[model samples]
Target chain A: MTLEITGLKVSLGGRDILRGVDLHLEKGRVHGLAGESGSGKTMTGLAVLGLLPHGARATGRIDLGGRDLLTLPPRELNKVRGGQVAMVFQDPATSLHPMLSVGRQLTEHMRHHLGLGRAEARARAVELLGKVRIPGAEEAYGRFPHQFSGGMRQRIAIAIALACSPRVLIADEPTTALDVTVQAGVLRLLRGLCDELGLAVLLVTHDLGVMSAIADEVSVMKDGLVVETGPRGQVLREPAHAYTRSLLDALPGEPGGPAEPGGKA
Target chain B: MSNTASGKTPLPGRGPEQARARRRGAHPLARFLVRRLLTAVLLAWGITLVTFVLTNLVPGDPVAANLGQRALGDPAIVAQWRAEHGLDKPLWEQYALHLQGLLQGDFGTSQQSHRPVAQDLAEFVPATLELAGAAILVSLVLGVGFGVLAALRRDRLSDHLLRVLSLVGISVPTFWLALVAFYVFFYRLQITPGSGRVDPALGGAPPVTGLQTIDALLAGRWDIFASAAGHLITPTLVLALYTIGLLTRFTRSAVLEVLGQDYVRAARAKGLPGRVILFRYVLRSALVPIITVAGLAFGSLLSGTVLVEAIFAWPGIGQYAYKSATTLDLPAVMGVGLVVGVVYLVINLIVDVLYGVIDPRVRLQ
Candidate 1:
């Protein structure tokens, strides 16, 4: 089973934001889309999830478990979202509904998508929280998002994404808002969840260091196009494109000398 | 991080202990409630003092206003009346006496009615409340509905139409609206009853609640209730229009702002049904400002009722206050001002409590 995107194109307000883009993410692996800001990395993930903003249009084929997501009607697409293909957003601080308890927010999607009873959903929610290493999962269920630290909140967010045991997960800049010390914990959690659940993950980030640590396969994107696609080791060591080399060189303490500062990578 | 990673508990430190100690101290909601209640009490006293001072400042002779032409003809009678009412005392003494009387629940006797101000309020305040309550009900129902509609259809023709309609509703003078309502509904259409609380045909049912429509219902007098309700329609509609306009505008903007938040988009991404997303996420967040505006609007509606009460000749405190103001009945004016201030503070306190309930972050803070 795999989540594949072919020739994805997204235009917002009649302006092309993402030109033709292709990505392949498989079960039991994390595929990282590494790019600079405004390089359309997040848009690619949004396109796969059919979450383009109002007035934005996408022409693409998003294949998930042999079903073409782009062709599915809204009703059918909704069944896929939060059920078979869920997403972890960039900012945990704002991604959660401020008014809802973490437990209610966690259980809502499972109840709606999986038809789980309230009791069953509650039990599963606590289990999911535990899976994310939340302390006192039962007590945490009654607490709102504001009560949690940023790292813990992000862990809860990941638990929400994994509520229905979706085949594919899209984590868009999942650790960008977190402190450097806390970032490793969240990255580790995502990696462990992938390995244990055998879930395919599309890990989008601008940080090459994050991609190097977590991603098995990496796609280097520049200006809405994937410049290089290979195993993380090969691409980092033996760069194929000038943009890819600059991206690697941009990393702190990376060899091959720094390119012209402020130049577009 | 390593402590957590190693699956061992961290060493005891001041940070966590301090946080726990803080949490164990006075709960945030309790603290907030205590602070708000103290403020409300202080504010009520301040309002009473200000109203008393302002009434004293106005250029008018309370003795003349009370005694009418008799004060001009007989100086001895005027002096006796002023002394009896304690108006002969110094301003500071008058204020202290007034404050003492207020503490004892005595608002003083009205110059016009010669009845205790408190008694007049009891007879009139209910009528104003009934009218204002009905108006608020109408405003909430229509305002929230139209606001949600406009927000959902933002920037569309329907949205533009609603915006223009609310603009006109807000700009239209309430007194003028009451007049126009009388002209059209009472004069031309002849659909609504023109004036008074109830028709004389009903034999004026015994006052229980002091609200005619309600009292009529309780007495099972359908004809009286119908007549009372009909009389209420024009004034209620006029009063409701302004609130509806304000609420609709506020609700629309608030909902629009909430709909644009990142959390709303996150809700959509969770595959929540559009209806669920709209109500649970967008509307819930939008309700904070709406509740605030609704509370403030209700306070203003109480004041607005004076003009409406005058036009309809509805026996409410607003009408009493208006007549008292014209006759320079300082005690009655002060009583009305004090009541309005108290109502405003109470409503604001309720709104603050509601904010804490609706949003836990507020309570926790």
Candidate 2:
């Protein structure tokens, strides 16, 4: 086990956003978190990193390896973030600072967490950009966020997330803002990188089709509670809960048409 | 749909094409500056024209207003006075002569002061510039500071107090505020210095930069500098009150907006220090709007100090304008109008240039 979240409860402004949630992500595997909007899917991701909104109260254990993340001091938590755990947000456009260059954004945290010098960080950032398949990695480094397309910006965001080579990655709807064709390429890159690095990934999204495509294990959530969790094939093909069944049925084409594996998984 | 936008991605070997495209237009900033200069020239010309026409159109004779009824009764003196000022020429010829003198950097003679309008403005402009400059500096520092504090403590007691103070600053009339400040600080409390630029005993500095504080500094006159700075406090605070209010409200909203951006959250998730996130990510983005509002506030402060200047008895351009307008000093009125117009144009140009520097999107566009 790489990350274990047990009985996590979060409340914001006197309202329960996440009642009680449990999730476990294993090394070298992708755990897909499936839910509709306002169903605590994104809240769980924020909770794990202690990046929840202001005035939010959370009570639970978020264990990474042996340390309970919820109990760590801010100084220790800062080391864990971008070093032990990293995150890629939903919309790449606004996630990256508009005023900063792509290379600056990619290398800043690398220098902060890994103690890499300027030259070392630059070389690693360029390699990461190339690894993410950006067409001209060296030239793209100095360019601003607006200079790149949505798909390319998302790829740069991923490169920044993978900069310090953390053990766990949380990607919240990474492909929701891209075109269908571009989405396939980004999803493939995400899966390939996590597998190559043997990192635990918590992929959060509302789309079941994305869950079918890359997720190794699937967890279905509704109204701040996880309804079902199992292997990808069992959950996507068999969906024990009514909410999960309705979610699977709402997909386009056949009931489980797009989710049906074509010789993989 | 962003389909067309997505198609604009740069591929391999496109660097040279991009460079060539840039070369065709020159540097964006250089081009932008050139455009702004041209606009300023055209606007300055328009201001001179309107000032000349409007001053002439005021239904009063400068000859009668200046030389009085006894001089107007004498045809010879009236004709000589009119001819001396080029009022006897055709309107078109008068305008042509005015433009010709302006091109030669002559602002003509002022009937009220019996001196050249250029010389009169030179003496008066420095005082107003010094006063407004100090006011804007004070307002900007206090306003941005208060604005950020208020935003950080949203809905708290300090925020409410600041909000109320700004509202009072904005709504209170300048003339009344200036009077009350002068009365309380100078008359009642005796803490601040009385009106005018400096004490009569100091006898002013050598007319170097026209700004008394700097001239005093340049001359190494610490006594003169202290006196000049002491005299500046009441009037500067009165003039800065409105602007401080304006900037506080604007900056509060601007900072609040930037604090909510997704990039701020992303910056936090990167494990950056709190100070780093606040300055680099939050305040940097907030600065664009703050700069814009501050520029506008500074412009208004420069031109809008007439009431404060009057109440404080400061020998600035506002007093000159009031005297010139009441006495029908056409040349002087036109000169004041031109200076005010040019100040606004120059400030707007600076703000536009700053926009390109702050946001790269502005530069590329």
- Tell me, by TM-score, which candidate is best: 2
TM-score of each: 0.92, 0.94
Estimate, for each residue in B93-204, the C-alpha lDDT of model 2 and write its tens digit: 9988998998898999998888999999999999999999999999999999889989999999999999998999899888999999999999999999998999998899
Clashing pairs in 2: none
- Over the stretch A1-265, how does candidate 1's per-residue lDDT look in tens digits? 4988998888888788888899999999999899899999999988887888788888878898888998999999988888888899989989998988899899998899988999999999999988998877887897889877777888899999999999999999998878766777888899999999999999998887788888899998888888889998888778889998888877766565322211222
RMSD of 1: 3.6
Which lDDT tens digits does candidate 1 get at residues B234-257?
899999999999999999999999
B168, model 1: CA deviation in Å?
A: 1.2
Score candidate 2 by TM-score against the native.
0.94
